[model samples]
Target: MKQWLQAFIAAIQFLTRIPVPVNVPFTNEVLKRSTLFYPWAGCIVGVLIWGAGLGLQLVLPAGPAAVLTLALAVALTGGLHMDGLMDTADGVLSHRSRERMLEIMKDSRVGAMGVIACILVLLLKWSLIASLMTAGAWQLWLVVPFIWSRAAMVWGMTNEPYARAESGLGSYFQGLHRGHLLGAVFSALMLSLATVYIMVSVPLEMAGWSASFAALAAYAIHPWWLLLGAPVLGMGAVWGCSRYLSKKLGGLTGDTYGAMNELTETILLLLLVLMTGWRG
Candidate 1:
C-alpha cells in the first residue's frame, strides 16, 4: 500500500507541475509501477480542465474561456508533452536519414517545422473547445481529452521498445510486461466511467431546483457504452502511431510517446465534436 501510494505520487510529480512535497524514490521498479497511475494522474488533469472550464464560462465568453482553459492545461504540464511534440515534429519531418532525424530531435532547439506543428495542434484544440463551449453541459468532454491522451502514453511505453541507444527518461519504463499495460488500461476505463457520472452529477443535484436542469440531467445521462469507446480508441491510437514511429525510428522514444499523447487527445476531441454535431 505504501509503495503504491508512492508510485501514484511519483506519477503526479513527473507528469504535472503539481507539487507533491513528499519524498518519492524513483527506483526502476517504482518508475515501472508508476506507469499504472499515469491514467490517475490524467484524471487529476482532467478534473482541473473540467473545473477551470466551468469557472471560466461563468464570467467570460466562450472564446476567452476556451483560451484560458487551454492555457491552463499547458501550464499545468509545464509544456513537457508539448516540447516533446515539437521535438518529434522536428525529427520525423526532416526527411533526412532516420539516424539524423533522431539526432535532430535530441537537440534543444525547435525547428521551423516544430513550430508549425505546435501552432496547428493548439489551433485545433482551441477551435474544437470553443465550439463545444456552445453548451456548457459539454464541458465534460474537455476533461476526457487529457485523460485518454495520457493513457495513450502508457500504451505506447508498454507496447514499443525504446528507440534511444542511450538511456533516457523513457528507458526506465522499457520492458514493461502486459500486467502494467492492463493496469493502465484499467485505470483509463474506470476514469472514463466516472466522467459519465460527472457530466450529469451537477445536473442531477440541480434538477429539483429547476425544471430546465431536470431536463438537462435527463439529456446528460448517456448510455455507459458511449464512453467505453474512449479507452479503446486511446489504446488503438498508440498502437497505430507508435508502430509507425517505431518503424521509422527503429523504436519509440520519449518524444514519440508525447506525440502519441497529443495525437490521441486531438483525435478524441475531434470525435467528440463530431458526435455532438451528429446528435444535434
Candidate 2:
C-alpha cells in the first residue's frame, strides 16, 4: 500500500507541475510502476482545468474564458505534451528519412514546422473549447478526455517498442507489461463513469427531474451514453495514430506518445462538440 501511494505520487510529480507532498524514491523500478497511475495524474489535471474554467466563466465571457482555460491547462502541465507535439511535428513533417526525422526531434532547436503545428493545434483547441463553453456544455465531465488520453499514453508505452536505443525519458517507460495497461484502463473507465453520471445528473436536475428520474436519465440519455463513447473513441484514435507513427518511425518515442495524447484529446473534444451540437 505504501509503495503504491509512492508510485502514485511519483506519477503526479512526473506528469504535471503539481507538487507531491511526500518524499518518494526515484528509481527505474519506481518509474516503471508509476505508469500504473498515469491516468490518475491526468484526472488531477482535468479537475484543475475544470475548476479554472468554472471560475473564469464567472467573470469572463465564454470565448475568453475558454481561451484562458486552455492557457491554464497548458500552464499547469508546463506545456510538456505540447513540446512533444512540436518535436513530433518537426520530425514527421520534415519528410526526411526516419533517421533524419529522429535526429530533428532530438535536436533542441524548434523548426518552422514545429512552430506551425503548435499554432494549428492550439487554435483548434481554443475553438473547440469555446464552442463547448458557449453551449454551457463544459461541465465536470470535461475531465474525460484528459483521463483517457493519458491512459492512451500508457497503452502506447505498453504495446509499442521504444524508438531510441539510447537512454532518455522514453527508455525509462519501456518494457511495461499488460498489467500496467490494465491498471490504467481500469482507472480511466472508473473515472469516466463517475463523470458521466455527474454530467447527466446536472442537466436533469436543472430540468426539475426527481432524484429517481435523474438517476434513470443519467443511465438513459442526456450525456451518459454519449459521453461513455469518449474513452472508446479516444482509445481508438490513439491506437490508430500510434500504429501509424510506429510504422513510420520504426517504433514509438516519447515525442510520439505526447503527440498521441494531444491528438486524442483534440479528437475527443471534437466528437463531444459534434454529438452535443454545441456549435449550433
Candidate 3:
C-alpha cells in the first residue's frame, strides 16, 4: 500500500508541475512501475481543469472562458505535451530520412511545421471547448478525455518499442509489462464510471429506483453513450498513431508520446462536440 502511494506520488511529480512530498527513489525501474498511475495523474489534471473551466464560465462568456481554460490547462502541464506535439510535427513532417527526422525532433529549435501544427491544434481545441461550454455539456464529462488520453499514452508505451537508441525520458518506459497496461485501463474505467454515476445515476435515483434504472437504460441508448466509447477510441488512436510514427521515424519517441496524448484529447473533444450538436 505504501509503495503504491509512493508510486502514485511519483507519477504525479513526474507528469505534472504539481508538488508532491513523497521522495520515492528516482530510478528507471521505479519510473517504469509508476506508469501504472498515469491515468490517476491525468484525473488530477482533469479535475483541476474542470474546476477552472467552471469558475471561468461564471465571470466570462463561453468563448473567452474556453480560451482561458485551455490556457490554464497548458499552464498546468507547463506545455509538456504541447512541446512533444510540436517536436513531433517538426520531425515527422520534415520529409527527411528517419534518422534526419529523429535528429530534427531532438534539436532544441522549433521549425515551421511544428509552429503551424501547434497553432492549428490549439485553435481546434479552443473552438471545441467553447462549443461544449456553450452547449452546457461541459460537465464531469470534461474529465473523461483527460483520463483516457493518458491511458492511451500508457497503451502506446506498453505495446510499442521506444524509438531512440540513446538514453532519454522515453527509454524509461520501454517494454512496459502487460500488468501495467491493465492497471492503467482499469484506472481509466473506474474513473469514467464514477464520473457517470455521480453526474447521471445519482440524480435519477431521487425520482425512485425504477426511474433511475430507466434513465440508465435511456442513457445507454442516448447519443451521449458515445462518450463511453472514448477509451476504445483513444486506444485505437494511439495504436494507429504509434504505427504511423514508427513507419515514419522507426519507432515512438518521448515527443511522439506527448503527441499521442494531445491528439487523442482533441479527437475526443471533437467527437463530443459533434454528438452534442453545439448546444448554444
Candidate 4:
C-alpha cells in the first residue's frame, strides 16, 4: 500500500503542475509501480482543464475561449502525447517492416503521415472543444475521458511487452503486476466519482439554494449517465492499440501508449459532444 501511494504521488508529480505534497523516491521499484498511478495523473490533468476552462469562461470571449482551452491541453503536457500520436502514426503508415516502422518512429524528422495526423488531431480537438463549450457540457464530458485515457495508457503498458530493447518509457512499465493494474482502475473510478459529485451534484445543490447561481448556470448541460462510457472506451482503446502494435511490431512502445491515450481522448471527447446533441 505504501508503495502504491508512492507510485500515485510520483505520477502526480511527474504528470501535472498540481502540487500533491509528494516527494517521489526514484528507485527502479518505484518507477515500475508508477504505472498504477497513471490514471490519477490523468485526473490531475482533467482538474486543471476544468478549472482553467471555468476561469477562462469568466474572462474570455467564446472565440478566444475555445483556443485557450485547446492550447492549455497541449501546453499542460508539453505536447508529449500529441508528439507520440504523430510519430506512431508515421511509423504505422510508413509501409515498412516492423523494424523499419520502429526506426521511422525514432526518426526526428516529421514525415508526411506524421504531419497529416497531427493536423487532423489538432483540428478535431479544436472542433470538439468548441462544441463542448457551446453545449456547456465541457466539464461532464471532459472529466472521465481525460481520466480514462491515461488509464488506457496504464493498461497498454502493463499488458504489452516492450517492442524495442531501448525504445522509450514502455520498456519501464511492461512488467507491471496485476496489483498495479487494479490500482490504476480503482484510482480512475474514484476520480470519476469525485468529478461527478463536484461537476454535477454540487452545482445542482448550489443552484437550488441560490437563484442568482441558477440563472447564471446553464441547465446541467451534460448528461450524468454519460459518465459510464469513459471506462468502456478506455479499455477498448488499450485492447485495440496493444493488439495492433503487437501485430505490427511484435510488442508495444512508450510512443504507442502515449499515442493511444491521445487518440482515445480525442475520440471520447468527440463522442461525448455528439451525445450531448449540442451543435456548435
Put down candidate 3 lDDT per residue, 209-248, tens digits, no spaces.
Answer: 7876765453232365565674567667778888898789
lDDT by residue (tens digit), candidate 2, 252-280: 89898889888988898787776655222
- State model 3's lDDT: 0.84
Tell me the spans in candidate 3 whose CA falls farther than 4 Å from its real position: 205-232, 278-280
CA lDDT, every model vs. true structure: 0.82, 0.84, 0.84, 0.76
Clashing pairs in 2: none
For candidate 4, write residues 86-152 as lDDT tens digits. 8899999987999999999988788999989999989888888777776666665477788888877
RMSD in Å for model 4: 3.3
Q: Which lDDT tens digits does candidate 1 get at residues 1-280?
A: 9999999999999889988899999888898899899988888987888788888988999999999989998998898888999999999999888899999999999999999999999999998888778744455656777777887888788777888999887887877888988898888778877876765676567655576466665335244455557456656766889888888898889888888888888888876766564353
TM-score of each: 0.90, 0.90, 0.90, 0.86
- State the displacement of the C-alpha of residue 43, model 2, in Å, after optimal TM-score superposition: 0.9
Counting clashing residue pairs in each candidate, in order, gives 0, 0, 0, 0
Task: Give the CA lDDT, 0 to 100, for residue 49 in model 4.
Answer: 84
lDDT of 1 at 118: 95
